[model samples]
Target: MSYSWSTEEYSNHYSTDFDTIEECIKEAKDMGCKAGTTIWIGKVEEVDIRRVNLTSILEDLHNAVYDDVGEFAEDWYIEDIDSKEAYEKCENAINDLVVKYIEENGMKPTFAKVVDAELYVIK
Candidate 1:
């Protein structure tokens, strides 16, 4: 893995990669940054990318629909009580929905997966 550092004052520019965190910090101090100056250190690592399926996307939409409609029901009589089942029906029509979305938006839906990294601060 390679590591680099960036300071708040020069956030747009990141330092060149160093093999060790100690080398990164030494370079930062040599550059005249004071003791209290805030800096961010980042390390690059290889991550795996996986394809997401239509069923997973539809399930997320189903959960959102339930949160918006079912969760707020005030009484026995609620509006759009069948909204949750709409997702089940969507499994059959998902292809049509995707085609329509591509036709109207000129692009397919996209999703991203984020990986969290631990931050180490040097005083």
Candidate 2:
């Protein structure tokens, strides 16, 4: 796998992919990255999209439902609803919401996971 390098002074900047860490280090020095500057080396890996966590969404929905219904009943509380059923019902809605949001506004900013990552200080 190709390797790339970045430093604290240029966190947003990465060197071109090289066959070796030794090449990355040489390029970092050539670019005048100072001694003691922290450097990171790694290969970029794609982020996997998976199911979204629904607990927080369920809790929020529960609180909202509780707030509206509790106004008319003294005994109403958040735990009156079954969480598993609630989660099951809202799963598609939440997923659809996320998909809609991504379609309208584009996917949220994501960073690649650096595999076989290493850190060093400029010498």
Candidate 3:
């Protein structure tokens, strides 16, 4: 596992293997990263495929499917069997797409993120 950081324009990018969150933060500060700069810490994935923004996909799904349901609405519950089924279907769809992508492009390391100084897995 590794960690990396990129600023708004991806300036002064820093990547290191097994760097603590404090260390990363210190580096970012030393490098003059702005206050709101996003410090992404994760492992490096080696893959032949182009990067796909899974976060965007998930966000789009949320806005389209889950955003409209109110708290007290009939569709608000996710623990229900129907909801669970739908969730599973969505999950399967994502898995299928990812698998197909990997099949076409070859395997690579999964995306990385930081979790309290620890490397977080994306897949």
Best by TM-score: 2
lDDT of 2 by residue, 25-72 (tens): 889888888887778888866564436667665567667776888756
TM-score of 2: 0.49
Instruction: Say which prediction, candidate 1 or candidate 3, comes out ahead on TM-score.
Output: 1
- Across 25-91, the per-residue lDDT of candidate 3 in tens digits comes to 6776777766666666544434334444444665665555655764434443333345666766776
State TM-scores per candidate. Answer: 0.37, 0.49, 0.29
Query: What residue pairs clash in candidate 1, if any at all?
Result: none
Q: How displaced is residue 107 in candidate 3, in Å?
A: 18
Flag regions of model 3 displaced more than 4 Å: 8-14, 46-123
lDDT of each: 0.59, 0.71, 0.52
The top-ranked prediction according to lDDT is 2
Show the lowest summed lDDT stretch of 10 residues, model 1: 109-118
CA shift of 13, model 2, Å: 7.4
Expressed as tens digits, the lDDT of each residue in 47-111 for candidate 1 is 32233344577456667777789865334332233566764566447666666766588664342
Report the error of model 3 at residue 45, Å. 3.2
Please give the distance, in angstroms, between residue 118's alpha carbon in candidate 1 and its true position after superposition: 6.2
Q: List the pairs of residues colliding in candidate 3.
A: 41-113, 42-112, 42-113, 45-109, 46-108, 46-109
